[model samples]
Target chain A: MIIDFHAHVGSMDSIGARLTADAMLHAMDAAGVDRCCVFNIFHADAAFGNDLTARFVAAHPDRFIGFAFVTPHYPEEMEGELARVFDHLGLQGIKIYPPYFDRTVEDAIWEPVFAFAHARKVPLISHSDGRDPLVNPNHGEPQMFVRWAEKYPDARIVLGHAGNFRSGRLSSIAAARRCANIFIEICTSWREIGSIEELVSGAGADRLLFGSDLPLMDPRIHKGRVLTAAIPETAKAQILGGNAARLLGLAA
Target chain B: MSTSDFPVFDCNAALGRRHNRRVAYDRPDDVVRFLAAAGISKALVYHPYAVPFGTMEGNRFLLDAVAGHPELVPQFVVSFAVDDPDEVRAAAEAAGVRTLRVFPKSHGYPFVDWIAGPWLEWMARERMALWVPLGRNPEVDIRDLYETARRHPDVPVVLAGAHYSNYAAVWPLLKALDHIHLDLSRFDAANGIERLERHVGLDRLLFGSDFPEVDPKPYLHYLRHCGLEENGLRAICRDNLERLIAGERAV
Candidate 1:
């Protein structure tokens, strides 16, 4: 069973990427991915985007799992949105993209979101990329997430993209090693020859999860990486689905 | 059927020690060995140190390091700021260098036509290929590459290491330029390769792994499962780059 822990739904005009449920289903089928954790793509209305995700996941519960989305800029509506997503929509996790609001995961605005994830025992995933120096350089740094991991000790915080740059991969590994709560999701287009090996060695196989960033990235790329990595079969199994299954409270 | 049925030819690979502690395959032999083990039969490689340091030293290091391995082809790194255009051209010709990569951003060279005019002319005359690893810095923008390609129509230019962020600008360039080619290592956009193949011919796309920096296995899988025809798959995985390299004229 393969579980893609990172994927986006809805249209992102900023990057010219858009994916509907039908398109994602086709992509999943093509890549042979069993399940995927789907989330919103930071549209104009965060609440509406979450509703779209909820409906999409509800339509295909067996194939898709929903992760709630909340724009931290609207702190007043965050609590209500979280409640609606979890209680009404049945979304399992929280996803925060820093670049959309130009705020880091450790920013004061995200404290409530972090606190909620800790209390609920649901994993929190955030977009982390160290390559975008031109814009939002410090927003997704691995060190920032490490600080959050230390602060929110009980939260299962997964750093999405695992630092999507040549130099950032080391930072992700180092950050994951520094905090046990921080798990690195291996996604994005960038993969150092032994990046997965380094993650396994530093953070253990249980701390690494497979993510495709689908619609933004090809699922085949991430699947192929795990399948072809020099790591043991046990570790590969954990990365592909076992780790995510445990996080989502699903049967292994 | 296994994905390893066809041998791959990676066009953008790097060798030697890096100043940063990121790379897993730092040694030249290890780069070749790992690529071969990953089912890549041939690779065009450049030394990583050459981009930051003088290109002359890096080129020499690359030639000497891959001397024993015939499957590992040497791609000389050239910098107009450090090396004289005339001397570098002569040396490249003498060294049997068919393909050269220039890092304008790292080497502190402007991407204007004047700076690259002589070198571009020399490459065009020699029928050699010019590679630019774009999007590393703000200066190495895709627009500047389009301008360079516009200036030198005869030169076969390959843009390597381009990310999806530059695809917006790259789209127009793909439509306009015939001399332009793209390395498929960082082609991560959703259905990007398919889109590119539709918008531009598959002949303009070349297979690359960004080896030592990134693994070749996943990219090999991407090409295999990319849903292209058998001939299109062969062209991208091997034939296209082979044709580009074969265009290198000794005279």
Candidate 2:
């Protein structure tokens, strides 16, 4: 089964991304993706984003997996928001964006979220970019996740975009090597040639997950990277869906 | 449609190593083998050296690298700041180079008409296509590129590595200019290809991989499954580039 580990639903006017549930479903069906992990990192109110994600997943429960988005901006609301996301919303994972909050992933403000994920044993995915001049590279660098992964070994820490560029990919691979809890999601505008293969070889296929950064990127393009990577079918399968399935506790 | 059904002619690919990261395939033979494995029938290849190193030597290196590989078409990199326009034209003619790429930002030259006019004018005369990468680090200024392409309307300029972030700027460029084209390597905006087909039509879109920096198969898969008609698919995946390289303006 093909599962996209990253996707967004909502109108991000800043980036001109407006992905409704219907549009996301159409894209998923067109790309032959069996399931997707949907979230909204753009909404400032954590509950609003989770509500949007929950609504998107509720429309197509079988085909969509809802991931909760919480920010360090509302330190007081983090715990309660996460509980609502998991308990009431029935969301499976957590999504964070350090760049948007203007805080690094390792900041003291995110400790509660990481601690919550560890206690819940749910996956935590965050946007990670290295050396991208467009955004502050230091905000979401993959290396920052190593500390969290080591601290919260039970929590699945997926580096969204796998650090994005070359330096970021290398850092992601290094972080994944250091922590078994760490996973690399391959989705970025930077379609660096041989990146999938490099990620697999550097961090192992089991540690890599396929993501499209949907509504802003195409799933077919990211899926094609895994399908055409010069790797074993087993490795491809693992990266494509098996790893994500294992993280989300889905059927193999 | 399966990927094999479409004959892919990658219009933007590089054939040498860069200083930043290790590429999977850098040699000509490896690139050919890789592209063949990826089901690409043909590719317009430039050297990474051309951007960082001297254009004349880089172009020479590119010619030497793709030597005897019919599948790998030579794409020379020209810099008006470094190489004289006449010398470049003469070399391109001698080498039978049909496509020329420019890195105005990397080469430290303004992409103005006065600086690039001679080279672009020569390209227009020869019917050789010009490739400009918009998403590369230190991106090509869209305004400068717009002005340059506007001044030299005859040059079939292909914008390479343009991703979704460039949609707002690129959309107007496509609507305004018939000669301007977009490569699909990094144009991965959600349903972007379909949107472009509906708004701008498929004639201005061309298939490119930015290979060795990007994998081509995903884009091939994207084009095949993106809901375009077969004729439109053919235009984007292969024929459009052939037309542009042949100096035919968009219909």
lDDT of 1 by residue, A53-92 (tens): 9988989999999998888768898888898889988999
Scored by TM-score, the top model is 2
Q: What do the candidate models score in CA lDDT, each in turn?
A: 0.81, 0.86
Backbone clashes (count) for model 2: 2
Clashing pairs counted in every model: 0, 2
- Pick out the ten consecutive residues of candidate 2 chain B with the lowest summed lDDT: B134-143
TM-score for every candidate vs. truth? 0.89, 0.92
- The DockQ of each candidate is 0.54, 0.62
Question: Which CAPRI tier for candidate 1?
Answer: medium
- Give the native contact fraction of candidate 1: 0.64
Clash count (model 1, backbone only): 0
Docking class of 2: medium
Q: Ignoring the other chain, what TM-score does chain B have in each prediction?
A: 0.93, 0.95
